[model samples]
Target: MANYERKIPILDCGHEYTRRVLHGKWKIRILLYIAEGINRPSELERHIPQATRRVLDAQLAELFKHGIIAKTIFDESVKHVEYYLTDLGNSLMPIVAMMGKWGNTHIDKLRKAINTSTALA
Candidate 1:
């Protein structure tokens, strides 16, 4: 083995900002679900049944704060709220798709390794 030198890179780029936008555990998943045409909170809940509503709401709020998604309310006999991707959020679609592609491509191997590790522990 050879010694390796690692240097800290400056967090002065869009990379850091992107990381901040997608920081939460559920954020990326939420984005994916939204991109897949599930934009409402209740729909998101049904799509991701494992996540609690509170946690999903918190992530949705963060996404809104980051200007990635926007919430709209309807004026009618029954009030309704829905979220749609902003331009900034649309910009991330390609990146997110690429990530999903990579993950799906390697998921079997990754899952096997993860399961092996978990079993060992």
Candidate 2:
């Protein structure tokens, strides 16, 4: 049995559910990479060198649990694993693209604010 659970249940709303599913730091990036055909775990690790393999695996598990991604394992001379986005995940690409566009559009202001906050921290 699980010993840990949220004290407050997640709100039964579309916005809240979406936020819960996409809450992890690396999840969005993982989704984007998988969509771009960087599906192997090792490949993802190479692409996101700042993220530890454990963290990436955890985020991948979360994505899988939420049905946003599917995993495939190939058994040959050597085992291989790959991840792919699900239909639900594919539907989110436009939203993700728009978010990226918005960030690029406001990069100057956003970068300044983020750097300021980091400096303060």
TM-score of each: 0.81, 0.88
Clashes in predicted model 1:
0
**What lDDT score goes with residue 15 in model 2?**
88
**Per-residue CA lDDT of candidate 1, range 85-109, in tens?**
9999999999998988998999999
TM-score between model 2 and native: 0.88
Model 2 lDDT-worst window of ten: 2-11
lDDT (Cα, tens digit) per residue for candidate 2, span 1-116 = 87998899868999888888899898889999999999999999999999999999999999999999999999989999999999999998898899899999999999999999
Which ten residues in a row are the worst by lDDT in model 1? Answer: 4-13
Each candidate: RMSD to true structure? 6.5, 4.0
